[model samples]
Target chain A: MNTSENMKARLVDYIEAFNAADASRVVALFADNASVEDPVGTPLKEGKSEIETFYTYATTVGARLELMAPPRGSHGNSASISFRVHITGQDGRPAHIDVTDVMDFDAAGKILRMRAYWGADDYHVLADAS
Target chain B: MNTSENMKARLVDYIEAFNAADASRVVALFADNASVEDPVGTPLKEGKSEIETFYTYATTVGARLELMAPPRGSHGNSASISFRVHITGQDGRPAHIDVTDVMDFDAAGKILRMRAYWGADDYHVLADAS
Candidate 1:
């Protein structure tokens, strides 16, 4: 498969893992030494343990992110995706988040690192019907 | 100059050209037979004349697009930018638009074609206080 297609498949797995609350599946997608950086200001998550901790918290807290845009980047072992996340917030509310996930890939197409960018102020938490 | 820097300079020129309402500045950046596809459903603008027509009408209507994100695509002679646009709607109102500009470049680093993706429904026309 081409690089872009390979990258997309990995992203789909990651998305499914989040939605399903399968922390192990999500953690398995990342390399053992992989790091996760969401936004420029936030501290980076390095190593499988740290990344595992981050995803475990977000997914367990009921953040179900639904993607809006497809993965878009070009001809590299990397892909940057823009997506809108729908999730149940801690306040028992629904929230929308626009995020850019910059990801790097390994030779076998596994995720090496992912840096996410989204500003907290742009989106607001709204009361959920459920 | 590096590819990203080259692409950014061209985009800045394109932005300034829009703000200054200069048709030639806009046209000069694109290649002679370049195609412009704004959204998947719209027809592509092939060649300089069509491109000129599109820009002339857009800028003439006082649509000034200010970029929010620096060029983010990596390596290749391509860049995808995300921006929040502030414009004066025809009804004499201020409007905010969120747009993504996907641009491709040649080996010389000039933009060859551009595909823009944004939905019209996301924004609404409001009365301008000015």
Candidate 2:
């Protein structure tokens, strides 16, 4: 795959891993030192260790973000993508957010870093009586 | 500067450029093809030309994002940063948001890509009755 396609594929795999609760797979897209801060009661995972720990918290309480095409520009070893996030809030309300992400690549085009920006509270959280 | 410090300095410079309405300085941190999507009524500027345009919108509204230290981890050419945004909403509310950003670097530590995540609605926008 090309750089952009590979990134798209990797992002898809990340969502799949999250839905399936596969920690290892979710961690695979990152380099050994990748970090994340998901905050907003989701997954504020940082670094390889914390990222693993953060994903561990999602073993039961279901949360998923179905992603659409992102706003993006790719050049050489770097690309920025913005995507619409459509998901059912934990409480089961209709939730949506358009997220923009910028990614840097290693010489081989592997994901070196990924940053995301979105309006999380725009999501209406319903009462999760489940 | 070190990778992390260089990134921080660049981020600071970006804010300064915005405050001063210096589009050229703001566009310097990015690679020739860098992109931006500052949604939520801010700046959804993409590509070089669009980024320049987005900054143009802020010239008169007097908008600014006073950034604090971000949550971050940097090793090699990658890092994730989360920071607190304390800004006077267009309506002049005591608005605040904790934003997380992920950045990637080229082999030379030049920023190649950047992604931002924030709660814009969480931002208390004053009615800009200006």
Per residue, candidate 1 scores C-alpha lDDT tens digits across B46-108 of: 999999999898788777776664544434456556655677766667886555565778766
Top candidate when judged by DockQ against the true structure: 1
**Model 1 residue B68 CA deviation in Å:** 15
Give every prediction's interface RMSD: 10.3, 12.9
Q: Give the TM-score of candidate 1.
A: 0.53
Q: Compare the candidates by lDDT and give the number of the best one.
A: 1
Residue runs of model 1 more than 4 Å from their true location after superposition? A127-130, B1-130
Candidate 2 residue-wise lDDT, A1-130, digit = tens: 3354465556566677877878777777676666563422234455678766766665344555554433232333444433444556655576654444555556654556665543332334445556
Docking class of 1: incorrect
Candidate 2 chain A least-lDDT 10 residues:
A68-77
Residue range with the least summed lDDT across 10 consecutive positions in model 1 chain A: A68-77
Model 1 Cα lDDT, one tens digit per residue, A66-127? 66555543344565556666776667577866665667778767789786655444355865
DockQ of each: 0.05, 0.04
What is candidate 2's lDDT per residue for B9-93, written digit by digit as tens?
5666666776786777766766656655342223445576776676676544555555443323243344444344456665556
Model 1 chain B scores worst on lDDT over the 10 consecutive residues at B68-77
Return the lDDT, model 1, position B63: 76
DockQ of 2: 0.04
